[model samples]
Target chain A: MARVVVDVMPKPEILDPQGKAVTGALQRLGFAGLAVRQGKRFEIEVDGEVTDERLDEIRRAAETLLANTVIETFAVSVETQEQAAAQGQPA
Target chain B: MARVVVDVMPKPEILDPQGKAVTGALQRLGFAGLAVRQGKRFEIEVDGEVTDERLDEIRRAAETLLANTVIETFAVSVETQEQAAAQGQPA
Candidate 1:
């Protein structure tokens, strides 16, 4: 099995209603000293070996659907259980 | 420091354009036996002790902004390096 971690963020220029809300609440909740950025992740478990080329194709698919290329940016990475373990995460 | 993981998923009935696209790609990529769902995550690092109550406040803030209580759903958890490591992740 393979793990794919993807993050899709709103176009920087576009207004993120949710992000705005969180920022506001942080200020009210005594977390005014910090700033917050919002994004998303999709943890997918796919069967079979994920070749680098195949992974790139998946990233493209995510970029096209999960993000607005016009303004938003996104990234995807594929790794195996051993790789994940080496990174200090559970296999 | 705190690392908060949040997942904001579109309402079940709402069409997930991103999720759909991924599904198509997975099938095309020879992952025909699988299904896909897409969601977002927020990783926030805040200084100071994260008391349980403070964490709740943060979750509420996230819900109001990052999640659509009406149609979408989300979940948030707070943990220290010790807890995270206990769960098998490097804190």
Candidate 2:
């Protein structure tokens, strides 16, 4: 099976209160950083290879239901067990 | 600045209603997929290099504030703007 990962992030202009809360918690926990932005990640497992057409369809799904396009932007990546193993990454 | 991405996913045994809902929506939208797993992604921008120590700190943050370790698992990645540009990937 092919695993497609869609990451939906808020637009830079949009306010991310959840992210802010996390940042606050991080600071309270004594972690230091510039900033934190929270987002959503969807892992879709599909049968067979993820062809160009399949990717296109997944992108459409991302745009329609996986993201709030009005305030968010998304990026897609494909992962497979074989590829993960090749890269020494766990699946 | 460096960008650290933390992906938190539910344990295999846990129920993911959000993911199921999305999968159902996609099928209704005429898109076919095997299954969908929903998760959270945190984008943290930190100043200076992301040293091993810093990564460890981020991992701690992930475990403490970014994930409910009892039912979730998390992975972290570091991204730099220059690296993204070099790879022709959007930052």
Q: Which stretches of candidate 1 lie over 4 Å from their true place?
A: A79-91, B1-34, B43-91
Best by TM-score: 2
Interface RMSD, candidates in the order listed: 8.8, 4.2
* Model 1 Cα shift for residue B86 (angstroms): 28
For residues A1-91, could you state the per-residue lDDT of candidate 1 as single tens digits?
7777666666557777776767677787666533455776665666676777657666666655555667566666564676445433110
Output the worst ten-in-a-row residue range by lDDT, candidate 1 chain A: A82-91
Give the residue spans of candidate 2 off by over 4 A.
A82-91, B82-91
List the RMSD of every prediction in angstroms: 7.9, 3.1
DockQ of each: 0.17, 0.53
Docking level of model 2? medium
Instruction: Indicate the DockQ of the complex predicted as candidate 1.
Output: 0.17
Candidate 2 true-interface contact recovery: 0.66
